[model samples]
Target: MALQVQIGKTELKVNPIGLGTNAVGGHNLFPILDEQAGRQLVQTGLANGINFLDTAFIYGPKHSEEIIGEVVKENGNRSDVVIATKAAHKMVGNEIVMDNSPAFLKESADEALQRLQTDYIDLFYIHFPDKDTPKYEAVGALQRLKEEGKIRAIGVSNFSIEQLREANIDGYVDVIQGEYNLLNRDAEIELFPYVMEHQISFIPYFPLASGVLTGKYDKNTNLAEKRGKFFQKELFEKNLEKVERIRKIANEKDIDIAHVVLAWYLTRDAIDVVIPGAKRADQVLNNLKTLDVQLTVDEIQEIDQIF
Candidate 1:
């Protein structure tokens, strides 16, 4: 049976395994994008029982949501799946700028609704915070949208602890999406505690640390130019060392290292779901395999020590 988890205080329940759809319609993000493969990816997830999907407007500037909308139509009703999307960036000529003003958020919500072909988004998030806008005021706009039946739940992504505290002052925020993984436990410092106290769900993006936790790369592996910070020699070497420890554990348990890493995340507090990106149907199936892997307290401790 698939594991069902609730999103914070919201009534929405979904399979713990969710798909991150950036690679699906994100033509600008990846090389040689395929429309058919992207549609098949979502179809495969729905066919296999994965109902939670995380996407953003900045992903291909608008393409991922479009593909998701098409897949939802072909699959069934809008309620059949939980759609989470973010909007905080707008293309200004050739530059993408972050805007968190009330007017822009409202406009973004309307655009997202039209693009997703849904009456109300399951969860709507502010993808990134702009310097000028007051965080709480931006969240207030989403709160109003929720009252007007435009969105079911509110989310804030890529926010600092201080920003999140301000945004959730009224406990209006339902979920938080952040960069977290075995390699990055910085959230444990303050963000995790606050979210847990307020009953907010923490949905981790880059849960695999840009595929490093999958144990596919070693010291000699040359990361692609697009890897950015992941391309740093010191960081890559450290990640390789940590992954080696995980690989040993996976070998001992007779499971894939990726499965062990993802399963271990469920053992932490306040993490309701994890959205690992998948460009192929087989990757979605492979991610779902995490459901079968189990980790003990000792193993969790060991994995933590490795990092």
Candidate 2:
């Protein structure tokens, strides 16, 4: 059965797995092996009943969003799927600076609309807050987008509790996106509590911890990348070691590691829509299949122990 979850005031039935387009043409950190493969991945995902797809404006230097727009346009009937994309981060000089100002948000929305070939997005997120931009500036910008009918809903990704509190002070934000996985639960401390009390959505990115909880990486293996190489260190190593215990529980339960971690998230009180990026068609299938796996309270507890 497909799982349907709500995001704030927006009511839409969605499969728990959202096809994330971070690597559509390629992210700034990762290079795309093939853009065609990325488009095919979206088609296959839609065919498999995935109605939610996440992408961003600055990916592939913005080539990825263009490709997504082309593919979704070619596929047609764009109404069948809910398109979720983010803004606020752009390349300025050699650094990736944040631009969450209302004016920038409006400009980015128009550009994203043209790229996605749609007038209104189902859910639009402010990619992340940066020291350069004020929270009210970002949140106020999103409020304007909502009023102008450019974006149907607004959310923020990668917010600390203090940051989230600042955004919600105006009650303009509809969702709060963060990196919450079996390993990372700091959001549970204050962020989740705020969301639960106010009825805001929690969209967890890196729900799989960059594939560490997927059981694909081990102590013997090392992660490297052009920009992703920055995450390699002792803390990451300890996190991977903790994943081994979750892997064992997944094995004993006869479920894939991704399923256990995803299903475990569903048991939480927060209204979550976890988007795990899949570079290939089969990975998309595997992630969507987690909808069928139900985690027991004990199983949820067992996995939570390591993180």
Candidate 3:
């Protein structure tokens, strides 16, 4: 049987692996973005049975959603795919701001709908929480939209444990997307327990740690071209050491290190899905190859200890 997972308690069932579209039409996030190539990335993933596509409004500041909308229109299979998009971050004048008020969120949803060229979205998320807005109030706005059939399910990303507790006060959230990878197991300490207890689906972003866990780099390798929190020399060396240990296991298993790292996430509790961004069609194909790699119980423990 093909792998299928029910997103939280909702009826929206999706493939375990998904495509995160930060690099798709995300001209602001990355340099050298080709609109046609972005469209092709979505097509390639869908062709390979990747039904879920995670995107955000701030990604390209609306560019990613526009490209995804183009692909869905051309493909003519809107019902066959699961689309998840988020809002809350917007540009006002020359500065970007986080606004979770009901009015702005509802406006964001309507704009997203028009941009996506769809009547309804599969999943909608509050991309981030503003300091002033009560967490539950922000969730309430999404709740209202869900009631109107504008979004199938509600999700929240980048929320703290306390913030999540407030957002899901009435148990309305269906999924939670956060950064969780082999290099960063911080989610396990608190977030996982609550999501497990509430039976909420946990979809992890940056599952590869910006490719640090892919075994393609070592301590001496210079990643001057990359920009992120993981680029520091001390942190890079520590992660490189962990990657080497993971590489040894991957070599023994005769599997791609990226695939091994991704598959290992499924071994964790309450990790319903993982969305790793891809810039090229081949990268999407490579991510799909992760489904073919499986780790044994002992291997899972060993890999866990290595981190």
Candidate 4:
């Protein structure tokens, strides 16, 4: 079994490598998806020692959480898994908007608990910041939920540094999830320092950069319309070059480049968990291989310089 690590100041402990379920049942996020494959992915992860499962309400507008709930219920191991889910999206007629009000967040939590078919959520994150709500106030709602035993931990995702500061003002925030990877180091500039000083765990999304950092693409590979601006010709070509350098290290170490990349993030400060999404059960198992990748200081630094 992979050793579990604490989620920020919370008692909830999870495998360092978690399964991101956006690709599992997120039909809206992805053009096409197999519901059976999504169920199998969650089942494979749980049976194979992966106890942390990350999902959000916006993913398929609720499908991901539903699928995860069904799997956990069927597996009969809800006690063994650490489930982290987020909410902020609310429907107003036909349009969706972000909401952080106490009532909305509390309602979202109750809805999530029902969808997850669990009595209590291990971790509940305010998925995104709304322009109208005070950041601290939004997190305060989660604090109240914690007090009520509805949730064990509070988290905020996609908040700016200032927003994070405001949200953590009461010291109720336990974790922060944001876009971070070797390719995108913006969080390292300020977010990393704050989280480390505050003893907050940082869960990095897109740890694989949508598969760009997996070392599967080359100059000849066509990714023009794939990842929008990130895959624009010039930058994509440049990133491919850096990935080749990572490939060299992976080859020398007899490991997959994706594993090397995931392992590298594990060594970073304030980064306690990496949720790499998988579309199939085999891919979920493959992500677990990252646990065995041990990189030396020299190798870590070399990869850092290459990025």
Best-fitting candidate, scored by TM-score:
4
Query: How many Å off is the CA of 81 in candidate 2?
Result: 1.1
Q: Rank the candidates by lDDT, best first.
A: 4, 1, 3, 2
lDDT of 3: 0.88
Q: Candidate 2, clashing residue pairs? A: none
lDDT of 3 at 300: 92
What's model 2's lDDT at 7? Answer: 66
lDDT of 3 by residue, 154-182 (tens): 99999999999999998888888898988
Over the stretch 37-104, how does candidate 1's per-residue lDDT look in tens digits?
A: 88998999999989998888988879999889889988976787999999999789999889999999
> Global CA lDDT of candidate 2, please?
0.78
RMSD of each: 1.3, 2.5, 1.3, 0.9
lDDT of 4 by residue, 124-184 (tens): 9999899999999999999999999999999999999999999999898999999998889
List TM-score per model, in order. Answer: 0.97, 0.90, 0.97, 0.98
User: Model 4: what TM-score?
Assistant: 0.98
Off by over 4 Å in 1: 224-226
TM-score of 3: 0.97
lDDT of each: 0.89, 0.78, 0.88, 0.92
* Per-residue lDDT of model 2, residues 181-269, tens digit only: 76667788888888988889788878877777787776666455412422477766887777777777778768788788887887788
Q: Any runs in candidate 2 off by more than 4 Å, and if so which?
A: 91-95, 132-134, 223-241
**Ten residues in sequence with the least summed lDDT for candidate 4:** 221-230
- Highest lDDT against the true fold, candidate: 4
